[model samples]
Target: MILDVSALLSGKVDVLEFDYIIPLLDEEGEATILPPPDVDFTSGIHICGRITDNAGYMALKASCEIGYRTACARCLTDLEGTFCYEFEKIAAKAGTIEGDEDNYVMITEGRLDLDRDVAEEVSLEFPTRFLCSEECLGLCPKCGKNRNLEPCDCANQKEIDPRLAILQKLLENQ
Candidate 1:
């Protein structure tokens, strides 16, 4: 679950390889279909990259693929997508990184929690919106029905002001 980067700092390198199912719980500890309920996350990482002696920091490159299910924002259909991210991390203790926050990964007590890190990165990679299809017809507002399943004319009707009723009739006849 975690690897001590302190060992790498001392030239005693160690690697972390793990596969596990992580629960996606909401603020109320309830399961959300937005990210599905449970997901299997497998990670095979080699932390063999160098730990700078002068700074007692690690510069490691990680390549990982995380798969999860997310409901389409428009169609409310379950869709699965894999997030593949390869990034270089300069890991150090939380308080050590001064100016460049983007270049650092915080290790608590010299231990890097790979599971948490992978989840964070993968979650961040998720698209802001998921669509079942590019031409998907969304739900209807008036009847609260899925337009994709059944087409509705209510959503396509043009609204006219009450004051323009007489003018609308004249236009309709024309």
Candidate 2:
């Protein structure tokens, strides 16, 4: 959504607050970033923040939270959680800021469009890997079984080089 900052920009207001929800879809009502089947993105994202006019420039502090149904990467265990991201940017009238323009969000026509910025920051912070626990046993490579679910009798030893057969024989004789 595009927010009008006319009052704040004109010195009529010192701060502008915003609270709203942004759909997870793109301009065409479809997703630009898709999560795995185990992760749900239907609930959308909630954002709340304020823009303070710090005399010459506006300081934007915003936070967004998204609800998700996730799964472990190794075991595929379902999980329900909410993830939050915080964004801060300096805003100045269009063409006012000089040099490092990339670090600031330039306001054009007394308006602020946070949709693109929020989408980008949230997408970058999205989880690429999920785990049920820190010490997840994962799945067994041999029998294609979940080692954490049950014990397997498969050999867990590593094979030695055949060139060391004489050393094995000597050790056995000892």
RMSD of each: 8.9, 7.7
Q: Candidate 2, TM-score vs. the true structure? A: 0.76
lDDT tens per residue, model 2, 58-165: 898989988888776665677678888888888778888778875677688988887777777787788876777866666544554676788775435466445554
Instruction: Give the Å shift of residue 161 in candidate 1.
Output: 12
Instruction: Give a tens-digit lDDT track for model 1, residues 1-174.
Output: 456666655566544333434345535775322342443333322222333433444566666555556666665767676656666777777787789776677878867765555556656665566677877766655554677898877546687455555543553343
RMSD to the native, candidate 1? 8.9
Residues forming the 10-long window of minimal summed lDDT in candidate 2 = 165-174
Q: What's model 2's lDDT at 11? A: 93
| Over 4 Å off, model 1 | 12-57, 64-66, 93-95, 107-110, 115-117, 139-174
